[model samples]
Target: MRNKYAIVIICIVALVIIEKENNIILRVSDKLSQFRTLQMPETSSFVIIDDNSSYPDDIYSENVLGAREKGQKHILLMATTRSGSSFVGEFFNQQGADMFYLFEPLWHVEAMLSLGTNGTNSSTSPWVYRDVLKHLFLCDFSLLERFINPPPKDHVTPDLFRRESSVALCENQVCTPVIKGIFEKYHCRTRRCGPLNLTLASEVCQKKRNRVIKTVRVTQLDTLRSLLEDPQLDVRLIQLVRDPRATLASRIVAFPSKYQDWKSWAVNENVSVKEEEVKRLEGNCNNIRMSAELGLSLPKWLEKRYMLVRYEDIARDPMQKAAEMYNFTGIPFTPQTRDWILENTHSHSSGIFSTQKNSSEHVEKWRFKIPFKLAQFVQEICGPTMKLFGYRFVDNEQSLVNKSFSLLEEKKFHFS
Candidate 1:
C-alpha cells in the first residue's frame, strides 16, 4: 500500500512538471514569432525619383501667353483616397455658376483600362491616359460622354452624382441630359464638343470662370505636364493632403466592403485596422513626399500656379481657408460661398462622406475614435511626413493621459 501510494504521488508530480515545461515552450515560441513579425521587411516597392530639374523658360512663356489669350481658368485637385477630396470638391461645387466641377471623370477610363474592355489592356500605356485627360481638361467630353451614356455600371455609374449636382449642371446648361441621352439635337454645342452633345456641356463649361476637376487617380505629377504645357489652357493644381493616420482610420471604418484587405491588418479583430493604418501611413508618406518634391522641381510658371492645402487646416477654419484660396485663384469670395460652407458643413447629410459636424470637431474626432496603440503605430510609420506637415505626434504617455482623463470625465459626468 505504501509503495502504491508513492507511485501515485510520483506520477502526479511528473504530470505537473510536463505541463509547466510545455507552457514554457509555448511562451518562447510566441516570443520568437512576434520577433519575426516585427523584423519583416518594412521597405515599400513604390519609389519617387526627385526630378527637381527646371523646364525650359520658353515653354512657360508660351503656356502663360496662351492661357491669357484663351481666358481659361483650369484647376485640378490632385489627391489620393481618404484625403478629404470629396469634401473639397463639394465645397468648390457650391460655387454655383462661377465654377464647373467634374467629379472623377477619369474613373471610367481607369476602369476600362483595368478590365481590358474594347481591346484595352493593362499595358495600354501612359500616353493614352495622358491624352484622354488632356482632351478632357479642354472641355472635350465626347470620350467622357461615351463612358457615361452607356453608364459604366461596372466601375462608375452616373448615379454617383448627387441630385443637386446634376440639377446644378443642367441649370447651367452643361448638358447633364447628355448622360441620359435626352439632348442629342444639341450635339453641335461647342467647338470642342464630341459626338455625344458634349459640345453643349463644353460651351456652358467654357462660360464658367473656373473649370475644376477633382481626381485621386494621378500617381505622377508629370502625367498632367502636357496639359500644363498647352498655351490655350490656364491650368492650376491644388495638391490636397490629410493626416495619414486619420485618413487610413477613416478608410478602414468607412470602406470595409471596398478595402477588403484592411480587415486582415489588425492583430485582433482591431489589429488588422492598425495594420491597415500603418500601410496607408507608409503609402501616404510616399505620396506626400513625392508631391512636395515634384512641386519644388516644377518650373516657375507651374510652381506658382499650384497650391498645397492640408485638409485639417481647411476644416479647422473653412472661411479663412476659402478666402485665402479665392484670393490665390483671383476668384471672388461671395456671401453665397460663406453661406454654403456653413449650411453644408453643419446641415443634415445623406451619405458617409457628409460633412455634418462643426468643422473643428470633425477634424479632431478621429483622435478619440482610434485605439491608442493603433494611432501610435500609424504615427511611427508616418512620422517624417507628419512632421513635415506640422502634425502633433501622439506618444504613449499622451495616449495614457488622454485615456485616464477621458475616464475621469466620464465618471464626473455620471456623478453629476
Candidate 2:
C-alpha cells in the first residue's frame, strides 16, 4: 500500500512537470484549470511549486521574449513546516497579479542533485541538481493558480498568464532570466568533482537576477553555519518563527525523537490522568531545552536579522499578521496586494494538522485529550516555561504546598 501510494504521488508529480513545461502562456490565475490533484484540507502546512504545477494551457498569451517586470516584485517566505510557514508563503504568492511560487525548497531537496559524501560517482547524480533548479527558475506559474483556488468542481482557470514570466530571448540558454538563462545548462554532462563549488552556485543565483530566496533554518544562523562562514558567501536571511506551543503541537511526531533517552520520552496510556503529568511535563521541558540550545547556538547577528511571528496571531487573523510580517521584512504591502490576501488567504492551521486554507487551533488540545497524568506531568515539567508565556496551570505546585500547610494548621488546632 505504501509503495502504491508513493507511486501515485510520483506519477502525479510527473504529470504536473510535463504539463507546465509544454503548456502555453497564462494570464488570470482564476481562469486556469487543474489536471491531477492532491487531496488537501482548506488549511495544511502545504505549498504548491508552480513549476511542478499542472493546468489547462493558454488563457493569457503574452510572449516571454520581451517580458519585463516593469518593476516586477519578488518576496520569499521562509519557515519550517507546522509553523504557519506555508500559510505565510501562500500569502506572498497571492500578491499583485500572478507571481512565482517556489514551494518548500529544502523539501526532499536531497532527491535533487546529491553531492555524494565526497562528490563522486553516484546514482541520480548531477542531473538531479540541474532539474531541480530548472523547475525553480522555469516552473509554470499559471498551473499554480488552480492550486490557490482550484475550481470547486474542476473548471479551467486563467492559465495564459504563466507564459508571461520569461523574457523574449534565451539569455545564453541557461544564465539570464532562467527561462533562457544558460549557467548550468550542461548540468546533464557529468563533470568530475571540485567544480560544483558553493561560490559558483551563489554566483549563478546572483546572475539570474533573483531578488530574494526563501528558506528557513536561518541557513546563516544555526544549521548551515559552515556554509555561511566561507568568506565568499553573501547570504541574507528571512528568519520566521511561531508560538512555541503551536510549533510543538504541530510537530508532535518529531518531538519524541529529540529526547536523549527513549525512557525520558516514553508514556504509558494505562496510567491515571494524574500519573501522566510527569511524562508530558518531561517532554515539554525537553522541547523547551532544545529550542534554548538552538537559540544559544544562534549567532548574535541572527536576532537582529529575524522577524518573530506568533503563529497564533497568523492563524486567528492572517491579513493583519501578514502585513506585520511584510512590514518587518521591509517588503512593501499595498492595498491591492492586501486586498488580494483578504480575498485568497485560505489556510487556518499552523498547528499539527496544518491544513491549507487556514491555521489550526489544536495547538494545545492535548491538555484535554491527553491523559490527566500526562497533563499533570507536562504542567510540572513545563510550569516555569509556561508561566513565562503567561499560561496558568490547572494543577500547580503552590496549590499542593498550600494543601500541605492547611493539614498542618488543622493538626495544630486539634493539639491546642
Candidate 3:
C-alpha cells in the first residue's frame, strides 16, 4: 500500500510540472511572434537593439521606448504654410490610435479676431493671440471660448471645421461637447452637432494621452518659450523647414495666378518691390529667424526638448527620419507606423496644398519648375537662411515649362 501511494504522488507531481512547462512555452512563442511582426529589418538604422544583444529587453521594451510615459505630453509642430506641417502632424495621428490632435484650432480665432466680427475688437495683438494659444495648448478651452464664442464667419465653409480634432472626437465623451459649442454658438448651423456637455472639454483635454497642437501662425520660437517653462506640461517643439527655392516654387505652383499677377506688377512698375513683396519677404525671413532663435537663444534645458527637422531630409528618407523623430518625442515608432509612412509616401508628387503624394519626388522640385532668374531672386532673398539650412543652389536651369503648364492645368482641374 505504501509503494502504491508513493507512485500516485509521483505521477501527480509530474503532471503539474508538465503543465507549467507548457504554459512557459506558450508565453515564449507569443513573445517571439510579437517581435516577428515588428519585423524591423536587421539593418534598420533606428532599431534600438544592439546587434550583440541576445534579448529585445536588453535595450528597451516597446512600452518604455516611445511616448507612453506615465504623464501627458504636449507636442507642438511649428512650421510655415506649405512647409509640410500637415504631413508631420499626421505622424502623431497614427491609424487606430487614440490621440488628441488639434489641426489649426487657432484658425477660427484668428479669423474672427482679424475680421473684428462677432463683437471682437482690433486690440487682439499677436501677443494676445499667443497667450490664447498657450492656454489652449494647456487644454484650457475657457480662454479659447472667448475668442471664438460667436464662431468665425468662415468656420463652416471650406471645411475648416472638418480638419479639426474635435470633429474626429465627437463620438468620444471628452470631445463631443467642445465641438458642439462651435456649432451651438452659430445656432447649430451644420449637421455635425451632437448632444454633450461642453464643460467637460477641459477635463478630457488634461487627461488625454497625447495632446498634439500644430500651428503655422507662429514666426518666433521665443513666443512659445513660456510653454517650455510650464511645470505641469511636458512640451516638445519640432521646427520644420524646407529649401527656400523649393518653397518658392511650390508657392508659384499653388498660386500661379497670384505670382503671375505679382510678376506683371513688378515688370510694369519697373519696381523690385511690390505691395505684397515685403510681406512675403518678411514672412520667409521670420521663419529663418525663428530657426536661428530656437538654436541660439533657447536655454540648454529647453534646447534638449527641441528638434529641428528639414523637409528635404524627411523627404529623402522618411522612415529613418520619422523613427528619429519618434525617438526624440518619446513616441513609439511601431511597425504600424512604418506601414503608414510607406503607404502615404509611395505616390506621384502633387503641388496642391490639400493633397499628398510621392514624398521622394518632392525633393528638389524647385529645380525643374522654378525659372532660373526667379530662383536666383529667391536665393538672394533667403540667402543666409538657405546656407544655414545647408541647401545648395543649383545654378543649372532645367525649366519644365511644358510640365509646369500640364501641372497647372491639373491643379486647376482638381482645385477649381
Candidate 4:
C-alpha cells in the first residue's frame, strides 16, 4: 500500500512541473505579441476577421487607398532645360503659404562643380545629385551650403541662384530686415531683403506641410530609385516632356550663345546627322526614352508614384492639369493657387525665365520659329521618343506651319 502511494505522489509532482512550464511559455508569447503590435506604424490599423463572409467585396479593387489624406508629402518636379518646366513648376509654387518651393537648387551644384577640373561630367553624376537632393528634402541646408559659390558666410548667402523664385525664401521672417527708408515697392523682395538666412530657411521648411524641388539637372530617372524607396519620405515624381523640335527651337532662342551652331545650321540649311550637336540631341532623346520605359514598367518601388505630363497637355488646359497634379501629391487646391494660375496663364508677359504667358499660344509658337530642315532632322533622330510621347510628325514646311494641323495626338498619361 505504501509503494502504491509513492507512485501516485511522483505522478502528482510531474503534473505540477508540466503546468508551470506551460504557464511560463504562455507569458513569453503574450509579451512577443505586444512587441509586434508596438512595431507597427501608427498611421495604419489592423483588424482580424473570423468568418469568410467578413471580407470586403472590393478587396481586389484598384486605387482603393485614393489620395493620401494625412502625412507629409515630398514632390520632385523633374524635366529637361527649355521643356516648359518652369511654367509647370508654378503650379506647385503658387500653393499659398503651406508650400516651401526650391527652384533649381542643383544650379548651384552644376555652377560650382564646373569650375573644377572634372567639369560638368563630375557635377552631373546621378549619385552626387541624389545625395544633395536627399539632404534638401529632409530640410537640411548644410549639404547645399557646400556648393554655394561665395561659400555661405555663417549660413548666409546673397547669391543663392534665383532666390526670388521661391516665395517662402523671400518672406519677412526668412530674409534680413530691410534698411530704414528703403522703398520696398520699388525693389523686389529678393533685392530688398539682405542675404538669405539659411538657418531661418531650414526652420521655415520644417514648419511647412509640403516641400517641392524643381530641377532640370537630374538627367536620368532610374538614378532616383533609392530616394523613391526611402522609408522616411513619401516622394512623388512628376516628369514633364516637350517635343524635341519645339525644345530645340526654344533652346536656340533662350540660349543663343550656347546654340550658335544650331542657329547657324538652321540659317545655312546644312544640317547633318553626324554633327556633334545632332549626336548630343540623340543622346538626350535616348535618355528620355529609357527613363520613360522604366517608369512605365511600374516597378515595385514606383507604383502610384511616377507621373508623366506633357508640356503641351498642361499648356492646353492649365487648370485641369494643375488639379490633377495636386490630387496626385495629396495637396489641396486652394483659392490662392487658382487665382495665380488664372492671372499668369492669361497674361502676355514673356521673359526668358518668366512663368507668365499665354500658354496655349506658346505651345505651337516653335512650329513657326524652327526651320523645316531642322524639324525634319529632330524628327529623324528622336522618332522613337516622339512616338512614345504621342508627337505627330510633319511631312513638309506647309504642314508644320498650318495652324489647324495638330501635332499632338489625343493620348492620356496617368499612373494612378
RMSD of each: 18.1, 18.8, 25.8, 21.4
The lowest-lDDT stretch of 10 consecutive residues in candidate 4 is 46-55
TM-score of each: 0.67, 0.40, 0.66, 0.80
Summarize candidate 4's per-residue lDDT along 1-416 as a digit string, tens digits: 99999999999999999998676545434433433343211212321111111213232122222213436788999999999998888888889888999999998767655544234455234655675686677677876776675567888777788878888888877878655653332133444786777889988987788889999988789888877876567889998899999999999999998898888877775643347777889999998888888887778889989999899999999999999999998889999999999999998887877899999988889999999988998999999999999999999999999989899999987586
TM-score head-to-head 1 vs 4, winner:
4
Per-residue CA lDDT of candidate 3, range 1-416, in tens?
99999999999999999998676545434433433343322322122112222223322232223433465667888887777778877777652344567777676556545544333333323444455455555555544443443422322222333333443334355323334234333222333444333345555555566677787776667655655655445678888887776776677677877667544543465645565675676566666655555554557647557877887677778888889777777666777768878888877756486435678776656566666666667767777777666666545454333333321111100000
Query: Can you give the lDDT of residue 32 in candidate 3?
Result: 31
- Scored by lDDT, model 3 comes in at 0.57
Among these predictions, the greatest lDDT belongs to 4
lDDT measured at residue 340 in model 4 versus the true structure, 0 to 100: 90
Regions of candidate 2 where Cα sits further than 4 Å from its true position: 1-78, 97-99, 110-220, 225-239, 242-268, 271-300, 344-416
- Lowest lDDT block of 10, candidate 3: 407-416
* Local lDDT at 239 for model 4: 87
Clashes of each: 5, 69, 4, 0
Total clashing pairs in model 3: 4
Clashes of 1: 5
